[model samples]
Target: MPRPLPDDLLKLPHRRDVPFAKLTTLGVGGTCRWLFEPTTEGEVQSFVRACVREGLPYKVLGGGSNLVVLDDIEIPVLRLALPKEVIREGTRLSAPASYGHIRLSQDAAKAGLAGLEFAAGIPGTTGGALRMNAGAYGRELVDVLQTFRFLTPEGELVEKRPEPGEFRYRWSFLTGGHVALGYTVALAEGDAEAIAATVAVNMEKRGTSQPLSKRNAGCIFKNPTGSSAGRLIDQAGLKGFRIGDAEVSPEHANFLVNHGHATAAEFAELMATVREKVRAVHGVELEPEVEIWR
Candidate 1:
């Protein structure tokens, strides 16, 4: 059995027995035993320090996108609730990790800044995007990322420019116990109307191509080297394939949608079947892009 959380850690703002269904975009999985919401960097540091001192394990949750919880998590979970303030220094804009990804893009457009229009349709918070190095339309967060602040595993804060290998396609070095606090993006000044138009176009493409009506945890698998995962799954005829309430989306095979009452087990089974069939047909093994917490 796991040991109880220390008293200092419990003093943070938190909720008990919160369902994962409410915390994730996939809308499945069991309860989160303890969910801690730290509203400031100091609070976050305190939580991390206390957990480290007690030798207790904990998990950090962002906007809850790109994740699939397979079962109830008993460990204390940290979710930053930092104030959503944006700081602007000329062409650079910075925001707390808790700020919405899409909202930041829109804000950039409103400020007559370009470069973030591709993020207009991306879901989740800035911290989640940073962790995933999220992208769309051949543009990624790293392209415009200038500098970022994060806490080391030991709870020491550091800010610096990204180095090579630190950020890559749909991946980043901000793993293990590193916690992103905020980020600055260098953008080019542009016509507000033009930027808004570009953002709209991207948003429209997302709305049309993705199954917006369904509950999903974004793309289920990462595209292999030069091949698209959606195309491979579709060619393998896995689209619309269902195991219980989980189905490979007919609109986009890369997405697995929940049909109201889908369970985590059903989704896992469906993903496995899809991967197997795709491998059998194409001889290419597929890997999941979404993070799964079992």
Candidate 2:
């Protein structure tokens, strides 16, 4: 028998049987059995501490832009609902992890800040960006990240700069039980018009090359060494490949898109097929950039 949740956890803002398809950008997945949306940092910390104390495992989710859930999640899932406030102190901007990534980039651009220009097209929340070191056009979250605050595995809070080997390509050490709350970015001053123009250009590029009309969890795989994953997949002639409603995007071969009514099983199968085809032809393994939850 499973242990019951702590009494303190039941009072937080939450929902039951929320559809995963609704939460994630891909718009396909099983239901989230327990979706807790804590509106304050104290509520978030309390939930985590309770889980740790009771030997319960939990997952922290943000915008759900980069996740693929294959089955109904039974474990407790927490999504921060911090107030939507952005503060600019000096050349630094701080926001809760729940802040939208692309919107935050646009906000920074509008404020004449320059460092977040690369994040203009990245989806998900700021917390997801920091966790994955999300990047585009050669710049990443780690580049502008000043410092972040997160709950440790043992439910202790810490604020510190990312040390060497902490943040890597689409990966971070803030896994296991650690949950990021918020972070600050170190940006530079730039002309408002110039910053906005740069963001516009980035957005245009993404729209032209990506399969934006279709539902997807952003890029499906990480780029292999010395080459691009999309280029490799395109080269292998896998574009438009389909498994049920899941297809390797005809626009960008690296992206797996969900046509209407696509199933999680189909998505998984499509991903496996693409990986196999790429490995067979190019002898390169394509690691998934999107996190899979089962």
Q: What local distance difference test score does each model get?
A: 0.93, 0.89
Write candidate 2's Cα lDDT for 172-259 as tens digits: 8988978898999999999999998888899999999999999899888988878999998998899999988889999999788999
Indicate which candidate wins on TM-score. Answer: 1
Which ranges in model 2 have alpha carbons more than 4 Å from their true place? Answer: 1-3
Model 1 ranges off by over 4 Å: none
lDDT of 1 by residue, 1-294 (tens): 767778898899999999899999999998999999999999999999998898887888997889999999999888999999999999999999999999999899999999999999889999999999999999999999999999988999999999999999999998988899999999999999999999889889989999989999899899999999999999998889999999999999999999999998998899899989999999999999999987
Clashing pairs in 1: none
The candidate that achieves the highest lDDT relative to the unseen native structure: 1
